[model samples]
Structure formats: structure tokens, C-alpha cells
Target: MLLRMPGVYRPQGDTRLLCAAFHDANLPPGGTVLDIGTGTGAVALTAARAGAASVTAVDIARRAVVTARANAWLSGLNVEVRQGDALTIAAGRRFDIVLANPPYVPSVVDVDARGPARAWEGGCDGRAVLDRLCAAARDLLTPGGTLLMVHSALCGTEESLIALRGLGLKAAVVSRAREPFGPVMRGRADALVRAGLLEPGDIDEELVVIRADRAITDH
Candidate 1:
């Protein structure tokens, strides 16, 4: 088990799904990895154990940063855990691999969510954070590098794929699973329906792992 702070996003179906897909992709060994929105640093640790030469984890929450750092130390792994906006922290850096389990639950409250809700409440159609990541992914990865991101299909897997492709990254859905509404999703089901993201009574949600690779052939 890993250390978990009160407000950090916990590892669940989506987390395991991303890790599994990433492993199956067989990313090149001894490469650098960047884990954005890394709550407990689970993905970062996974990358390290997968033979990545280096792993950098970033989270916006202070508690999450502490939790991830503690977990990394406890696991006796070397992970550079940073507390800041992922984009800001990763500026001018490129990695051979990128992993993310971004918040995608549609939220009715507002686009700018806070506290633990910040962990899962995505604005409106639930792409607030996801969209930014897709836009930045191309710049964050080295040529031939792969980005593995997991999120609810309710947030629009096609949108993510399209966004990445628009940035010249080759993108596709590499893995998918149907998961029941978790606490946050269940709590915001009505909001999602109102936002036209879900139909009435849609209890089961589809989670997808999107893979986008910067083509090595590109200049």
C-alpha cells in the first residue's frame, strides 16, 4: 500500500487501468517519465519499477505532494515530487513517457473547483484540466515518447484524441473499462446529465486510456 493524504486522489480503477496499459505499451527502458497530477505518486513509482531511469511527479495540492513524497521514500524509490501546477512545473522539460489520471468528473458547481473536489470535479463537460494536458502533451514528450492518460469516457475520449492529433501526436484509445459511478461521479451524476454528458439513470461509466505518441519520424 501507498501513503495517502486526506485530499489526494486515491488510486482506483482508472489508476490501475492506466498503469496496465502503460506497461503493455512497453515503453523504452531507461527513459524519463513525467506523472502529472500525481496524487500518491503511484504512477511515478510504477514507472520507476518499470525501468524508467527517472520519474518526476507533480501535484497541485500540498498535502498530495507530502503524501506522494512520503510514499516514494517509504517505497525506497527515487521520485522527484513537486507541488505546483503541472504545466508550470514541467515547463521546458520533455520526457520519454508521460502518465496521468486527470480529474474528469463533470461538476455543476463551477469551472474553478477547490479542496478535495479539486481532485475530480472537472468543469462543465469535465475537460478543464484534461484539455490543457492534451494541448501541452506534445511539447512535454520527446519524439517517440508515449503519453498514457486515463479518464472517464463521459469527458469525451474522442475530444482528447482529436486534441492530441491536432497537436500532431498520434493518438488512440488503447484501453477501456466500464466502472460504476464512484463517490464523486455519483454525486455529480445529475450535473453531468444537465451538462449533457450523461443520459438519465446512467450508472455505469466508461473509463478509457488514451495513448498518444510523438512520432519519432517527425523533425
Candidate 2:
């Protein structure tokens, strides 16, 4: 069981889906891994247990850093949990595998309140954090390295692909699943409908796992 501090994002469907995809990725063994927006270090622990030579997790919330470090300790896994902006922590570092499950829930405002909601509330278009991550994917990975990310389809999968590809990485959607609206999404249904992000009767949203690989030929 993972110890979750209040306000830290709990592992849910998106987490499960991302873990599943990671298991199937068949990445090179003993690689260095980076987990951005790590919550309880669930995904980071997976990498550590999978024999990654090193696993580093970054989160903007101090509570998340504490929670993830606690989880890693409890699980006897080696995960370096840091509290900071993902891009800032990743500067000048390259990992053989990069994993992300950033905030992708479109919200009326940039963020609801600043506490727990920051974990899920994406800006108006839901690309605020996702866009930045996609933009940095190529730089975060070593040549021929892979990036695995999960986000709601409401965030525009095509846009993410285009961003990664434009950066010279081969990108594609590797997995897709339909999930019922959660409490947040359910509550925002009306506003989302008005914003044309959802249909009147649409009660479910699709989650997509996108995998982008840096070309071996790229310097």
C-alpha cells in the first residue's frame, strides 16, 4: 500500500494505465529513468524495481516529494524524489526513459485553488503543463531513448504528437482507454460542455498513452 499525504494525487486509472504501458514498453534494461510530476512515486518505484540503474522523480509540491520519498522508503525502492518544476530539475540531464502524467484536466481558470487542485487542473486549454512537457521530451531523453506519457484525450493527443515530432522525436499513441468522468470532471461537465470540450451527454473521457522515441541518428 502506498502512503498518500493529503493533497498529493492518489494513484488512479491514469496511473494504472501508465504503469501498464511501462510494463509493455520493453525498454532497455538498466537504463536511467526520470518520472515527472510523480505523485506517490508509484511510477518511479516501478522503474526502480524494474532494475533501472537510476530513478529520479520530480514534483512541484513539497507534500508530493515527501510522500514519494516515504513510499520509496516503505517499498525499499531507490527513488530520488525532488521538489521543483519538472523542466528546471531536468535541465542538463538526460535519461534513457522519461515518464510523465502531467496535469491535463482543462479548467476555467489556470488552477482551481492552489492546493490539491494543482495536481489536476490544467489551464483553459489543458495544454499548459502538457505542452511544456512535450516540448522538453526530446531534450530530456538520450538518443534512441523513449518517453511515455499519459493524458486525457480532451487535451488533444494530436497536438502532443506534433510537438514531440517537431522536436525530431518519433511519436505515436500506444494505448487508449475509456474512463468514466471522475468527481472533478463530472462537476466540470457543464462548464466543459459550454466550452465545447465535452458534449451534452458525454459522461466518459478517453485516456491516451503516447510514446515518443528519439531517433538513434539524432545527436
Candidate 3:
């Protein structure tokens, strides 16, 4: 079993969905892979298994970093784990592939709070971290590199596509799935109604996997 310390966001549907997306990406030989908001280094491990030359994972929570490191060791995978905001840690680095399953649940409270909540809360609009990544991702991608990210459609899948395209990447919804609302989404169902993101009785949210590629000509 993968090692998990308390407070780390456990791997779930979004993680599995992104894992499937990774199967479709064209990873370069001996390529470098970066997993943002990695919890227990699940995606990083998958990347290593897929033959990525090197894998690095970053998470904002200290517990998550520790848990991910432990899991990597237990799995006998060479994954570098670090603790920092996804955007900050990714700055000044370029990767052949970047993967993320960021915090997208619209929170009743602003997402600035630390603790277990930090793992999922993304403010009223739920794009707090995702938006930042769209803006900052180009700096972290080599020309022709790809970004594979997953999030709830409740967070505006179209918005993310538009943002990434605006940054000059070729972006599109590569895959989608409807999943039963998990604890966080279920608990915030009322607030989501108030936020106009859900209907009164909506019991599920669609998740989407988006792929964006930096053109080889971007250089």
C-alpha cells in the first residue's frame, strides 16, 4: 500500500482520470516530468513507470510532501518531492510534461486557509490555483511540451481552455467524466447553488481532462 500521512489529499477519481490522460501523452525519451499538487506522489509514480527519465512532485502541504516522499520510497520509485505552492515551485523550470489535479472544489470559505482544507478549497469561483497555472505554465514547458490537467466542470472547463489558449497553447478538452459528488462537493452543494454553479438537486459534477500543447514553433 502507498504510504499516506494524515492530512495528505488521498488519490481519487481526478487522480485516476489524469493517470489515464498520461497514457495518451507523448513523453520524450528520458524526459523530465513535473507533477504539481502531487498528493502521495501517485502521478509521479505513474510517470516513472511510464519511463519518464526523471519525475518531480510538488505540493503545498508539508504533510503531503512527506507522504509523497514516503510513498515514492516505498514504491522504489525515483521521484523528487518538495513542499511549496505549485506556481512558486515550478517557476524557472522547464519540463517535457507537466501534470496536475489541482484544488477545484468551490469552497464556502476563501481558499487561503491552511490545513486539510487547503487540499481542495479553491475560493468562491474555484479557479484560484488552476487559473494561476494557466498563466504560469508556459514558463514551465519546453517548446512542444504538453500539459495534462484535470478538474471539475463545475469550475468552468471552458474558462480553463480559453485561458490556456490565450497563453498561446493549443488547448482542448481531451476527456470528460461524470462522477458522484464526493464529500467536499456534497457538503458545499448549498453554497454551490448560491454561487449559481449547481442546480438545487444536482448530485453529481462532471470532471474534465484538458490537454494543452506549446507549439514546437513557440521558440
Q: Candidates' TM-scores?
A: 0.95, 0.97, 0.96
lDDT of 1 by residue, 1-219 (tens): 997978788988888998898789786868999998889888889988888899999988898999999999999899999988888889999999999888888777554587777788777778999999999998999989999999988888899999999999999999999998877677767877887878999998999999999999765
* Candidate 3 lDDT over residue span 48-70, tens digit each: 98999999899988999999898
Kindly provide the TM-score of model 3 when superposed on the true structure, using C-alpha atoms.
Answer: 0.96
Candidate 2 segments exceeding 4 Å error: 109-113
- Which residue pairs show backbone clashes in model 1? none
Kindly report which residue pairs in candidate 3 clash with one another.
none
Give the higher-TM-score candidate: 2 or 3: 2
Sort all candidates by lDDT, best to worst. 2, 3, 1
TM for candidate 2 is 0.97
Candidate 2: how many backbone clashes? 0
Clashes of 3: 0
Local distance difference test scores for all models: 0.88, 0.91, 0.89
lDDT of 2 by residue, 138-164 (tens): 899999899999999999999999999
Give the lDDT of residue 20 in candidate 3: 93
Deviation of model 3 at 174, angstroms? 0.7
